[model samples]
Target: MRVILALLLMAGMARAGSDRPGDFDYYVMALSWSPSWCALEGDARGAAQCDPRRGHGFVLHGLWPQHETGWPAWCDSDARAPSRSEIRAMVPIMGSAGLVRYQWEKHGRCSGLAAGAYFDAARRAWTRVRRPAALRQPDRPARLAPAEVERAFLAANPGWTADMVTITCKNGHIQEARICLTKDLAPRPCGADVVRDCRARAARMPPVR
Candidate 1:
C-alpha cells in the first residue's frame, strides 16, 4: 500500500506543470527583423521571406501565452489545427505555413483557443503594434545597441513603456522585438523572465533587401 501511495504521489507531481489550454496570465508578441533573420539563417534555408522582392521588415514571429514565471507549451487540445487556406493566408505576416503549423502545435495549443481563433488573436495582436520606420527599410547595414532598438519601438507605439518591450539578439544580429500584453492585447509590463533585454552593445541590423 505504501508503494502504491508513493507511485500515486509521483504521478501527481509529474502533472504539476502540464500545460492546460487558455490558462496563462498574458501574451508576448515577438516580431522578427527579416533582414537580420535572413542574414543569420534564412538565407541558408532559401526562405522565401528573404527574397529581395519581398522587402519584408518586421514580421510576426508569434504571439505566445505567458505566465508570471515559467510558461506552458504543447498542451493537448480538442481544437482543430488550422486549415491549409488559413495557414497560407498568414504567410505574408508569419513568413511560412510550416511556422504557422508549428506555432499552433507549440504555443498556440497552450492558448486554449482553437487554431483559427488563436491565429486570429495573433493577427490582431500583431496589427496593434506599429513597427519602427527607421528599422523598416535601411539601405545599409547599421550597428545599434539593443536599447536603441527598444526605444525605436517605444517611439512608434504610444502607451508602451520600457518594461513592456525587449530586444533579443542572435549570432551578433538583432533578432526580434518582443512586447508584453494583457490577455485582451493591451500593452503590459513583462514578467521577470520576459524582461531579459539583449546585452549586446551594438548588434548588427541588416538592411532590408
Candidate 2:
C-alpha cells in the first residue's frame, strides 16, 4: 500500500485534500463493539449481525487507510462492485451486503487491488488482531476504563502498544476500537489526534445479547 502511495505521488496525481487512489501511509482496522451497535439500533434488528442468536461480539467495521492529517475517501469511482459471494462472506464481520458494498466503493477502491483482492486483504487484516478475552461477550455488562480497554488489547495481541490504538465511545459506551497498522499489516502507532479522540475515564460495554 505504501508503494501505491509513492507511485501516485511520483505521477503528481495525489495532491493534498484530494481523494486519490492509494494515497495513504498506513491502515486503521476498526473493530465495532457490536453490543453498542445493537443498543443504538434498538428494536429494528434488520441487520443479520443484530440477530440475538448470532451472539456477535467485536465485529469488523472497516479496514481504512489513513494519512497523517486527514484520510481519503471514494478514491476510485469506476471501481467494480464486489460480487454476491464476496459480500456474503463478509457478512459475518461487516453485517450487511449494503455496508460491504459501500465500504469497498469507498475504502477498498483506494487500496490499489481489485475488489476480490481488497476484501481478501481486509479479512487477513481483521484476523491478525486477537480479540481480548474480556471484551468477548461477557454475560453481564462490562464497565471499564479507557486505559483498561487499551491494556486488554495490548496484552492479547503480541507487539501491539498503546500508541497503536484508538477507542471510540458515545455516552460513555464503547462504540469501537480502531487499531493502526502498517501498510504491510504490522502493528504501528496511530496519529496523536486519533488516540486522543476518546478520553472518557470510564465507559460502559453493553453485554452481547
Q: Which candidate number has the best TM-score?
A: 1
Extract clashing residue pairs from model 2.
none
* Colliding pairs, model 1: 22-111, 22-112
List, residue by residue over 1-209, the lDDT tens digit for candidate 1: 99999999765543345478988888999999989999988999998888999998899999988878767777878889899988987899988788888988989989998888888999999988988888888999899999999999999998888999999999999999999999999999998878999998999999988
C-alpha-based local distance difference test score of model 2: 0.81
The Cα local distance difference test for each model comes to 0.89, 0.81
**Model 2 weakest 10-residue run by lDDT:** 10-19
Give stretches of model 1 more than 4 Å off: 1-18
